[model samples]
Target: MTDTTAAPRLSVRTLVLMAVPALLIGIGSAVVLRALDLVSEQLMHFLWDWLPGQFGADESTPWWIFLILTLTGAAVGAIVWLVPGHGGPDSATTELGGPPPKLGAVPTILLVAILGLAGGVSLGPENPTIAVNSALAVAVFGRLSTKIPPALLVMLAVSGTIGALFGTPVAAALIFTGTVGALALPGSLWDKLFLPLAAAGAGAVTMLLLGGESISFTLEPMGAIQPIYLLQGFLIAAVSAILGIVAAFLFPYLHKAFHALRNPIIFTTIGGMILGVLGIIGGPITLFKGLEQTAELLEHPEDYSASQLALFTGVKIVALLIAASAGFRGGRIFPAVFVGTAFGLLAFALFPGIPISLAVACGVMGITLAATKDGWIGIFVGIALCGDITVLPLLCLIILPVWLIVTKAPELTVHPPEKAPAAAPAKA
Candidate 1:
């Protein structure tokens, strides 16, 4: 009369088995999303540049341009009006926090993100890419309807998403896993250990075929920082943080103003005209949208005099704020990075005697505000952007003080609070 059916602890081999799917998801997602990114880039290049030239337009249309705007408007309007969950499944409830809704929404998010990017909105494709990938994974897994834990599903989805977006399974695994863990999701300690390793390896293998660099940026330290140089770096971080806070505050209001316009096509049309005028006044620094400007700022920091750099930085902040507000459909991460870099470059010129290393550090360190309220994201960015991993500690030291000063104001609340069954999550 004895029945012994106790729960079995996961063996090392068993844990590894769970990780296998995550690894596959990561690799598969990476390959697919990279292709998507390329496709988006080509389409954007054609629409924003080639098509415009062919049409002989003197200026580029607003990112929302296109007969598609009417289409986008009607489509989005319908989705908003009719789809019960068009807003999307609650991300906060889902554990990943604010991700795309439903497996079916993946295609919709991809289409919207690509169109938005092509329209030259000031956003990055990474977020939308992540959303699409996650949704796809969710759908595929959901169909199986297997008895797998939801926590495992979330981790796998995130792993897949990171691999696809960053092209570095390891970094993606680390960051995404950390993000999930920080959010207090499920999965035992054993699950955490093997999952990332497997996912990262898969991601790495995928990127090897994709041909883009696995890491986004690296850092190299100058070594043995003296006091004054340190102080200068601190100052640069401080100023950039102040600027970031100001940007955060302005973004919400601008977005509201654009939405208030009611009609999408006319609103977008007016938005384009307004941006064009700003482009004229601000010069090419405002053109090609944010990415081009970020590149120019990094390469030719000296080309911009101190005054010009300051003016350009301020203009970009406003430009991004307005672009996002006008329903341009881009992400803000790039603009923030670009603006931070510009500010750092300008600070070097203005302060004089500051090391270029310091400028680089400050530029990245300052923009961390946009990464998350936690502030450490900016520090990581400061070092990560350097293209040398060794510089992280130094970057962190300098960013700490600046983060403190800038955050002294009422903190900019960017993401909605974590909640279950919230409204629709954005594509990104």
Candidate 2:
């Protein structure tokens, strides 16, 4: 007798139906994110352009920049300290795709995000955008259909938001592959990604329509991978990874030190002052979220000396640490990419023989891997930025050794505070 057993399968119709909600969520997320970007742009214009012009103070002046950042810090601190939901958990404690905060906390999260983005905090919109979208997604999808799991909703929101953030579905898909691949569920990985990919595609398209910037850059295409070039790439990647590891190790201690102040206003304000000083040292070019700065650095690599590039790299790293640790609500990845780009440029400047694109790609790979603890996305970003496929094989090879260096390194996140030494016995 022959036994009749059937393999588990997903219904095409079910997946197709799910895509509808996913697309809608993607578009919605894009619109919300675009609106926030516009608001941030207007506020920044007022702070950096209008206000400075009115006072007859050079907007690029270090002193004026310092004052604005310090004031921005105080305002953000006030919101986090006095606002409801404490600005929705310290961003230092959250991961890129962590659990969402409650719906009631969404408004506070948005406020904090706006303050951070417009205030020149060295952070990105990734965390708050994802958090807000996740919260809204859960609420709306939950009411619409009891059949859809909360986990799926979160994935859709994350996929959609990240798609919009990077202005591409590829980044979202690469970032989520490892996440969903680990699940012990039926169906192929693509099967699980079906709805989320639909969402991501929609989000990416929506962002393009809104005129968001793409992360890709035009670089001289690497002709071929030479052995010497391979070794050079490896060394660059190794050094960059070490720098990232050092930052990761210091992150927790910095968080603890800031929190020891016991008041958000005090710590964040102090953080702002330090960041302002760093900004002055690094100059106005190093000030914002680093996306535009990265482009500037790449476009005019000849304008800055090797030492200047190195300073930009160091200052941005320190600024990122300070901003993230001192209760600022933002993501670290964007700033990390900037740091990586600077490091790459510095490497190219130091050693003129190696192709600039290859050096930059390695730099990006190493630092991004250490900072994000996600290998695939790091590699993707590196290649995407360079827009050179010939370097892909080299990057693939370089990542092997780089991953070994970073795999055991501490992630850049703060754990819950230790139980205050068990509260020493009451002094009767």
Candidate 3:
């Protein structure tokens, strides 16, 4: 009888060779992300600190925030209109795993991303940074070696960028599990994960070495998982998921409304002005992409009243929707995290007995799931932010009901307008 078993397709030598480029790309991508962070920090410092100081105005001056955001909108609008490739594709039209834009589009994408990040536009660097890294890797590797698969290059770039963003390979692995697990080809699931895991490990290590901080917080850990807490967590997540669904339904309509202007300059500039107004009302706490702000919120949860937290949540959701739909180049994850945190704090204020960490984690999971439509990532970020393992079992269980709520919810993506057919010839 013929042997039914088959040998492994990739030998150890071949695997090691593939991993070499993955490792290099991971480390290199992490360094680039760090550099972007530095540049963004400098710009933000200049805008919020030095510029205000020069005007003899404190950072709390509401007019300055308004003026800067309005101008930022105008600047971003100009870049989109004048720059080549129209500042890359509209972020609203792309998913996290979508194909990277052409290499030539990278410059404009980076420019707009930096502007949005530093100029307090209420967006995250996740989308643009990933796209940039992926495009760069695909171009460089495609030219250097035809042996490397394009899919592999994209996978490495995405995994590496995610690793750097989350400050760990674990997040990358969890995030990509659903994507990789569905592949029909390959051996075991780990076999498929081998190269991406290698890249993620390198990226995470490199980012840590460069002094990048992970999204973690030290909270009062749960002593033990309780049935009551699980019930509460499920309820909280369900509520948050409903809120997220509401936002998802609103997303496409808002996107279309903004695009109705049909000119990037008019629409983006106007969107920026509205964002500036929201920033003024919401204060400094509601501005920016929100990772640092989320930490601040957790550290001083008592400082904010229930009303303030509610306002923060509402304003942040609006900002996220507007920033994404109106030509901003960034991701929704960080901003969604902020919204989730605000809602969690609001819940805590209302119900003092419920554990704050659990409440916050549930909120994060629901909102992130709604925004990214990725359950594993949502749960991971939720647990990671609280720095608690005890909450994992609860989260894993709670995510089921939350998933049901969001599964059929409209996705937070925009469809581009179709070009009208040319008019019939006048002679006809």
| Candidate 1 structure, TM-score to reference | 0.77
Window of ten residues with lowest summed lDDT in model 2: 419-428
Off by over 4 Å in 2: 1-7, 182-185, 417-428
Error of 1 at 83 (Å): 10
TM-scores of the candidates are 0.77, 0.95, 0.95
lDDT of 1 at 391: 53
TM-score winner between candidates 1 and 3:
3
> Model 3 segments beyond 4 Å from truth?
1-8, 181-185, 417-428
Candidate 2 achieves a global lDDT of: 0.86
* Weakest lDDT window of 10 consecutive positions for candidate 1: 88-97
Task: List the candidate 1 regions with Cα displacement exceeding 4 Å.
Answer: 1-10, 55-96, 173-193, 213-223, 262-272, 281-293, 374-376, 388-390, 405-428
Model 2 / residue 270 / CA error / Å: 0.9
lDDT, candidates in the order shown:
0.58, 0.86, 0.86
Q: Compared with the true structure, what per-residue lDDT tens digits does model 1 show for residues 341-380?
A: 7787787787766766568667767765643454555655
Q: For candidate 3, lDDT tens digit of each residue in 204-244?
A: 99999999978988677777777899888888888877888
